[model samples]
Target: METALIEYGNFLVAGVTVNATESTDFAAVWDELLERVSDEQKTATAKLQKVGVLMPDAADEGFTYTAGFIVQGIPAVAALGLTGVVVPAAMYATVLVEGPAADSIKPGFEYLHSTFIPEKDVTPTGVNLEVYGPGDVTASNYRMYCWSAVDGVESPI
Candidate 1:
């Protein structure tokens, strides 16, 4: 329900992603992700999301995306065997997602991409972010911040 221009520093994430353009249940993807995370994982942030956008006119069945925690290094999470992705510093149109990790998470991104981005007249960098709190997936007390990668997008909302 809030909007702002936020800056993030580089961090490592070992996780997964789905081409949002494809027909997929994003919530289930996150559930599968939870199983892959190592028990000893250390996170730089409570939670975060990273996505790669495909270029227009690009040849592909779907777009590219990545999701995971903010970690110190890829080696730190090498045990998980997940492909590591580094989130770089950039300004993003950020929004907060409330409720359960399995439920609140997906829609948060949807709001930013479907409503926030276009409303701002800004092109998504294709690097999306989601911030999560301590614990596993559920419908209890969980918080996540969904961020859209954007460059110099101004908002009046």
Candidate 2:
């Protein structure tokens, strides 16, 4: 498969999330977070939007990730203030991950970091974004778009 380096201008999002060292049970966790969002909708300052992902340092330390984004354009601070969740505001280079949500995209990510990126002489710049769309319809129907920024790529005009 071929991969391209591109830029995402900006986005505004908010939600709740958790972090786990063991591979996460995303389905159950996402559902629970959504429930919290639904119940708190009336008091929320920003709209609850889509789900996302953040990679931890290779060491996999405790509470290394976060969930939620605020309404005031607070860069990467999650609105819910979960222990590890923070919002990220920076340019990113993304790729679409199709197929099962479990490990289907691992190879792609490996290839991007190991092969494509080095060949292009670029370093990772911003947060890696995992954009979840309608594909979460079923256990096997999961689809997520993964993105990472070129170390020195500039913001779009």
Q: Count the backbone clashes (under 3 Å) in each candidate.
A: 6, 12
Model 1 TM: 0.65
- Give candidate 1's error at residue 61 in angstroms: 6.2
lDDT of 2 by residue, 23-68 (tens): 7665566566556554465356344345455655545564333344
lDDT of 1 by residue, 47-113 (tens): 4443332222235444555555555676745766666766666678788777886677568778888
TM-scores for all predictions: 0.65, 0.61
